[model samples]
Target: MADPVILVDRPAAHVARLLINRPDKRNAIDHAVRQQMAAALSALAGDPDIRALVLGGVAGVFSAGGDLPSMKGLDEAGARARMAHIHGLCRQIAEASLAIVSAVEGIGAGGAIGLALLGDEIVVGEGTRILFPFLRLGLTPDWGQLLTLPRRVGLPAARRLLIGGGPVDGAEAFRIGLADEVTADGQVMTRAIERASALAQLPRDALLRMNRRLEMPSATLSDELAREADDQARCLTGAEFNEGYEAFLARRTPDFSHL
Candidate 1:
C-alpha cells in the first residue's frame, strides 16, 4: 500500500506519533486526508501497546485546514456529511484514553485548529501561526471549532480571532492558553514525542479516565453525552459518510450524495 496521507508510528513502545504528511498542500485536509486521520487514530484507539498519542504536522506546517477544492463540489447533503465526519474525528480525539499532544510548528487554521485544541497539551514552535479564517469564506465553523475554540481562549478572544481574519503567532497563542509550550524551530514534534513518551509511563487507565472527566461538561452532563452518541449514530448511517469513507480509502475526493 502507498504511504498513508497521515503517517502513524510508534516511536516508543507506548507512544504513537501521528503526523499529517501533506506539507506541500500545507497539510490542507480533504476527504481522504480526514478519513486517513480518523483511521490512523482508530488504529490506536484501544491498542494495548499504545499509551499515548502525539499529533503533529510535517517539519513545520501543522495544517492550513480544509481543502477548498474538495469542498467546492459538496452539495447540501455532502456538506452535512463532511461536517459529521469531521465532528466524529474531533470527538474521538476528545475521548481517547491515550493522552494526545498537538505539536504545531507553522500554521493551523479552520478545522485543523480544532484538531490542535483536542490535545490535552499544545506545543507550538516559536514561528508558528494560528488562524481562524472560516468566516472569510462565508462558512460557519465546523470540526468542533464552534465547541472547542470558545472554551480554549474564551468567547471574546475566540470572537476576535474568528471575526478578525488574521493569524496569531506562537507567543500570542501561548498568552491565550492555546499553546502550552513554545519550542525552538523544528523541535515541536520532537518535544511532543518526548512528553508523550513520559506520559505513557503513567497508569494508562487512570490517565484516560482523568481526560474523560476533564472533558465532561459541568452542566447537563448526562443529557449532552446522550445527545452526542445519538447524533454520531445517525451520522454514521448517512450516505455521505459512506461515500466519504470510500473516497478517503481510495485517495480521492468524495462524491457526495444530494441527500
Candidate 2:
C-alpha cells in the first residue's frame, strides 16, 4: 500500500504536527487528504494533553493548492459539496482550541494559503511563494478565503491580493502581515514547531476564549464587552487561574498540565 497522505507526529508533549505527505503531487489537497485531515484534527481536538498544532507539508513544499486532476469530472453538485466539506474544515481550524502554527516552504497557492491562514501563525521560508490564483483559474476564492484572508491582512490588502495580485515571496508575505515569521528555507518546520511549543505553554483555555472573541469580526463593542465580561468571569473561577496566581505569587512558572 502507499504511504498515508497525512502524517501525524508528536514533536513535543503538547504539540501535534500534521504533515501533508503526498510529495509526488507536491502535497496537493484532495478528497483523501481532506478526510484524513478532518479525522486527525477531530482526534486531536479531544486530547487534553495536546495544546498546540503545526500544519506543514513534507519535502519542503507547503502545498500546490487544490488537486486540479481531482476536479476534472466534478459536477456542480459535487463541486458544491466538496467546497462545503472544505469550509467545514476551515471552521474547525478557526475554532480550534489548540494554538496553531503553519510551516510553509516552497509554495502556498490559492486555496492552500487560505487553509494556512485558519491557523494562528504562519512561518515561511525566504523563497516560499504565496500566490492568489482563483480569478486566473476562472474561479472565486474558496477554502474560506473570503472571510479568513480579510481578517488576516485586512480588507484592502485582501482585495488587492485576491482580485489580481501576482505571487508574493515569503519575506514580502511577512512584511505585509501574511506571514508571522520568515526564516531560511531549511528551518521552516523547526521554527514553526518551536513557535507552537512555546504557544502551548500559555493558558490554553483562556487563549481559546481570547481567540474566539477576537476573531468575531461582526461583534460590536457592546457585544464584545458583554462576551468578554462573561468569559473573563469564567477564567477567573477556573483552576488555571488559581494555578497562575499561585505561580505569580511564588515567582515561578505555572504548570497547567491537566489543570
By lDDT, the best candidate is 2
Model 1 misplaced regions, further than 4 Å? 220-259
TM-score, per-candidate, Cα-based: 0.80, 0.96
Which clashing pairs does model 2 show? Answer: none
RMSD of 1: 13.3
Cα deviation at 17, candidate 1, in Å, is 0.9
Model 2 worst lDDT run, 10 consecutive residues: 212-221
lDDT values for all models:
0.79, 0.89
Question: On a 0 to 100 scale, what is the lDDT of residue 97 in model 2?
Answer: 84
Can you write out model 2's per-residue Cα lDDT over 147-171, one digit (the tens) per residue? 8888878899999998865589988
Name the regions of candidate 2 deviating beyond 4 angstroms.
Answer: none
